[model samples]
Target: MRSRSLVVPAVLAGLLAGSVADPASAHEQVSTPSAAVVGAAPASRVTAGWTLVARYGFDGGRPTPIADESGKGHTLRLVTRNGGTVSAVRHGIGHALRFPGKCLTGRRCPHAALQSPSAPNLNPGTRPISYGAKVLLSPSQTSKGQNVVQKGYSATSSQYKLQVDGAAGRASCVLVGARPGIKLITSTVSVADGTWHTVECRRTARALTVLVDGAVRGNRAIQPGLSVANDRPLSIGGKGAYSDNDQFQGTLDDVWVRVG
Candidate 1:
């Protein structure tokens, strides 16, 4: 409802012409693991061995009381702050949810996100886990960083997160384990090209990998013994209704999480 009056800039039609992603943060202690571009794998093959913990096709416009298609019963609750809004948008053969971009220059920007109640099944402690979404973002929507999906908090507890960072909008996967270290991997390419792209974050015992359209874009070595488990809700589209949240400003569909 609130988004009906919002007008997007026409400049979004053109993709990033000559944008280079910023280097990873020095405090994050980023690492580069061997990247293996295994080519695009079919949908069926992508989840061949993993168990689907939660999945949201966002069909029918992501109506309230959002259902989790995985049948694992991880229903998502919508959260809004300030004047944040969520609206329906056309995507491929079905529909998706579109979120507001940055807040007006000095205005208290809107904030909206979807969160799931704490569930043990969603916590894949010490296990290989993968999560991702089909996203459509424009250069104008890029921000310092916007969370796509995450469980737990990096500062207070272990966490597994996927987010698009910097003006380049290069996706990244993060792993904060039981120890006092963070494992992060950022994509070598940007996805803020005003097109649909599948971005996934895969965490294994060996390393943390980021995949764009099923090809490895970046990888970072991680401790094999690390574990992630917490009572925090699984958040999507941003961190929640909090102020200065990492709100995502784009369309999202077919979000899913799997573990082995």
Candidate 2:
């Protein structure tokens, strides 16, 4: 993977401040949206619902994939370029939704960052590895239940990694256990056709169902009894380990999140 360029001193300072300042705020005296703002323009000029939390089109040279929205919801959408990847991150300062990936190797890459107080920043890290197409979510630290849905085309790769702060394993997906033991969940799907596909994971009342493009892919009943924390922010194309330099190597679009 490549290292991203040094974030602009001002932008980095602003990002580190936990509040994103509008470019025109300091000198031009322009008003910026607060975390309460929601349902504004999308990054790709695509139309979305009024409750849109976050959206991305990957139309710029930067790595951050968050859309400039009104800041209503806590969800985020990441769009990948020809061979780019997107990631949703939650840092300690606030909620920074970003997509930092490797393209040419050893070069500094750009990533997305969104700061919001409404969401908890859990499991902070560098990046994770994703094969084919995937979506990641860091559940609310206050809630024991969680869900994630991914829809896109699948590709072939030697590495397909998904890491959760709550679990550790080699399974396609694993739920960490802050209490007792970690449970591993794996699903089989033919997602390497380079065509759009979808994968979903829903957790409620001790049951988990994995879906592919709206179709059921696998179902698992477990008593891992692992509780997902809302304080942890979700990472998509990257992991929270801050180590494994693996990043998603593909294109992604259209991401959605629903909370109970």
Candidate 3:
């Protein structure tokens, strides 16, 4: 059985691993948490059967620990680069993180993201997995591609990512097997119309599917044995606080991950 003492220490470890020691060199910092913690994230029927690994509502605003709603202790820490910033703002009646859009040409672009430490449970291995976020983006913010969330890098290892691609603001799901090359399927409908939209990506033994607003928008076949596993953190908003990191410029709420 899990004890409070054990849980407390594990949570502390997660905090330390996420904290930014030096913003100048590291370009990020975890904010000091508040005394009162928010309640667990609202349950999702979409994750009814699968095990929820992590969930963030961004409820407490900036500088507070981005609590993992799943209660699995995979809290997220904020990261920023250049002049980037992330703020906790009210979205409809709930809370969300607002990120700055891309900067003009030749200008230093600020970048921001949320990340969790590499943990065994976060790696789905050969199991099916699903991840998604409630996003609000504008057509003007669209670019070649702006990553919403991802784990692993295809150039180095297997990866699973959801990104909005092209000026059309089309959302797409991507997966890279242990082998070379990328496997992607894009949504037929664009979600970059300045309205709140729920976008999700699911990877099964047979295929990869992207869903928008609870409706299937794209699907692609895949090898039944294709697998995804890596020692990389789960990233949101962008890959990291680095230059040209496929930064997402918009608001994000209820970001979550489930594996089975």
Candidate 2: misplaced stretches above 4 Å?
1-65, 68-171, 240-245
Candidate ordering by TM-score (highest first): 1, 3, 2
lDDT of 3 by residue, 147-183 (tens): 8988887777678888888899988888877765577
Q: Please give the range of 10 consecutive residues that has the lowest summed lDDT in model 3.
A: 1-10
Cα lDDT tens digits, model 1, 142-253, are 9878889988777677888898888999998998887667778888889899999999998877878888987778776777888989888888897766565578999888
List the candidates' TM-scores in order. 0.83, 0.43, 0.81
In model 1, what lDDT does residue 102 have?
70
Best by lDDT: 1
- Which rank order by lDDT, best down to worst? 1, 3, 2
**Which regions of candidate 3 deviate over 4 angstroms?**
1-47
- What is the clash count of model 1? 0
As a whole number from 0 to 100, the lDDT of residue 92 in candidate 3 is 59
Model 1 CA deviation exceeding 4 Å by range = 1-46
